[model samples]
Target: MCAMKYGLLFFVTLMATNLVSEADGDLMSMIDYRYFRCVMKREWKCPDSEINFFMYTPEHPRKHFIDPRYPKLLHDFGWDPMRKNVLIIHGFNGTYSKSPMTFIRDAYLSRKDYNVFMVDWSELTRFPCYLSALSNMKKAAQCTAQLYSAITQAGALAKMITCVGHSLGAHICGMISNHLTEKQYKIVGLDPGRPLVSAYGSRQFRLGRDDAHVVHVLHTNAGFLGESGLVGHADFCFNGGQKQPGCKGHIMRIARCSHFMSSCYFAASVRRSRRLVGIPCDTSCPKERGYWGINPQRRAVVLGDDVPDGSRGMFCISFENTEDCPFD
Candidate 1:
């Protein structure tokens, strides 16, 4: 009788301990990723080893799109219907639950007034740090078809399509960059991984002379590209990349940081910041005013002589304030 009692107590203690020590993957509350990015602020802090552990695991992402409520908000705020699109891709370790595209879709849905998208071809996925070689790049590039497909699904008339990629996600973004747009697309690479540019080669990461006018890489955690790459941005801005406060850097938040989520922080901020408008100019008019998203309240857009006077179309001005700015 005593032995049976001891066994029962032991089993109860075991269950209690298991309940108290939850694994990172425990499905309880939805992770507020934006609230816990790699920066070290009061809201987002984690041990270094956890950051590393988080990157190696693969989370199959559920496919997602803009939430329905977004359009209503855009209409409420008086946004233009004819505007461009922006696609945000997450890096290796940054996926939502099981779906790599979850937060990406969340980003699009975050600002429903504008055309936004998430790009994923998990079938061709490679290890996060493996961008040091092109050995698997050929297989990884197969995702271009999906890339083209998603762009078509978003809108064929979109004047410009910008690709924002981080870390390995940037490499994945680079893989399809060649075909992500109809004419030329814009690309924003944030702390692009070291192996990414080299493993994929420069051809994999490019912004055409006529390709949407610009490409930028925020070099905070850039292990390879020098400080100049950060400086070279026409609108180059730093995230503090993997190390910004509020969001823990990968090196520090290794447990929570993944190749996918690291760059995603920067991508999310940039993706939601632009102000989009439409201008109905005659086809004969040059594609003068490039599409941009301005808060129309907190921020301003000052076009210069250098502002892509490139041959494009005229833009109609209509304010589409980014709904509840993601960075906020």
Candidate 2:
């Protein structure tokens, strides 16, 4: 009887093991699809903690970049009969065609007053701040080119335009300023993450007065950069920084999977431009107080091919942008 019981337990264990193996196989396949490109893989690793270890080092954009998930974001946005211009950008690990962006799409669609557009960049996950700042510089230039083409095509005539970015998307906000024409602009950067400043120091990157008129950076983490120093984005602030009053943590937040309902805040603010949305600004930090990095002249972060020769980006190459680029 004892031997029979032992044999029965062993049989059950083997069956369980087989089932787990099958489940793991399914998971692994999904992983392949999920981490489709370097940009997605890298930027998604969040909270900047040791726990977020790099699963695989992604190949550069020129390498194995694949399909851009944000199709609507890249579309030529020309309103019927024309309206004001508005460009919306996504941050790290974000796709304009995906989740939060879906909410964004709906938000803009609801408001017919603005000629809505989106900037689908090189995968945000692929370029670290240091690398992204440099490589994305040109991509930024090209995207702005596209936006202008879009603006021209739509034939929209308005006083000024506005650009909104989230986290990594905020970096694109800076990039647009660097590459585009100097227009009276309104850039709202929500929870702009520190552009993955490298070991040497933080990069001197910011949306200059040249890009947008009043560029506001709403900060969440009170790390190195205080309330000042963010050039281009003249209005540097915080979402009350860290744990603010109105936010209701992860699950309960308005929409999407983001820890904070950042997009909702972004949309709310975008809807009510010119007027203060009152979305919690950290006025506590003394104004005009921002710490500088090591080499201010050269941005502290290197990006794209400029991602320091030695430094390897976190995600591996899955495909190339040219292979799947939905461009003319």
Candidate 3:
């Protein structure tokens, strides 16, 4: 009787294994082969120590670490409830100390007396681990949501806060809403990561129009490293949304350079609002010869920080001179 029981247990375990394999096969058919290879292979749950928040004020340009568990530490670290808050999240392989997203932080600080928070989850989403990084985004977003909650509870108005993110960081900003009772006011998604995300990620896992009152997406390297077409309430396709003129290299190298340029362009716009203007386009970046023929009747909209909250549509803009474009 004991032998029979052991045999039955072994058979049950084999069936369970087969069931998991069948489910995995179905998922693989839905996503890219590269993503299938790494999908949930090494899922990660980031600890509070691995995710960190830093606050920067105009008076104190230096960043001060703030723990969400200790909400009072926000005031101790020079967080001002009266001032508008800007939360900047970095992409894969990025840290609060240094990254292209820092340009946006610097721009906000220089332009106005605002409280800036940098969300760093670099240890969980380090380079060469894109798959694991994708898996860890939800945990990172959950931890950051706690920081956002603490800020609002400490008297910072939700309407006065804006979340700015680049690449995978963009999706993290959106996912924060999943943990909140109310939605965010504004979200600037700079070149939201494409790859496996754009193809397989659902709205809950990616940046969407409903994530915030105003979701502005700027595409600098669309269809390659960045998500193409409209992914937000307002989508701006700079230089056709595929490649920036100033970025010079082979295809992949240029795409990387273009991806980084989104932050640079946003920084420039914060400093000089309404300068980088765009006009309504049919979801496609217009060629140089065809750009002039676009309907002049369409009202032009400003790109970046000052974009009106109610704005919606796909817009395209090109630099008459490459020198005007910002490059990192």
Highest lDDT against the true fold, candidate: 3
- Give TM-scores for every candidate, taking all chains together and pairing residue i with residue i: 0.45, 0.50, 0.82
Sorted by TM-score (best first), the order is: 3, 2, 1
TM-score of candidate 2 against the unseen true structure: 0.50
TM match of model 1 to true structure: 0.45
RMSD after Cα superposition, model 1: 17.6
For each candidate, the alpha-carbon lDDT, in order, equals 0.36, 0.38, 0.76
Question: Who is ahead in lDDT, 1 or 2?
Answer: 2
Residue 252, candidate 2: Cα error in Å is 17
What lDDT tens digits, residue by residue, belong to model 2 across residues 68-149? 2222332222234334555666654345555554455455555655545555553433322223333343454344544554
Q: Candidate 1: lDDT over CA atoms?
A: 0.36
Q: Comparing 1 and 2 by TM-score, which wins?
A: 2
Q: How many clashing pairs in candidate 2?
A: 29
lDDT per residue (tens digit) for residues 229-311 in model 1: 22212332222222223434333333223223334444355344433222223221111234332233322222211234332
Q: For residue 193, give model 3's deviation from the true position in Å.
A: 0.3
Rank order by lDDT, top first? 3, 2, 1
lDDT of 3 by residue, 9-95 (tens): 545423322221211233234334443233232333323777888899988889898878777778887788789998899887677
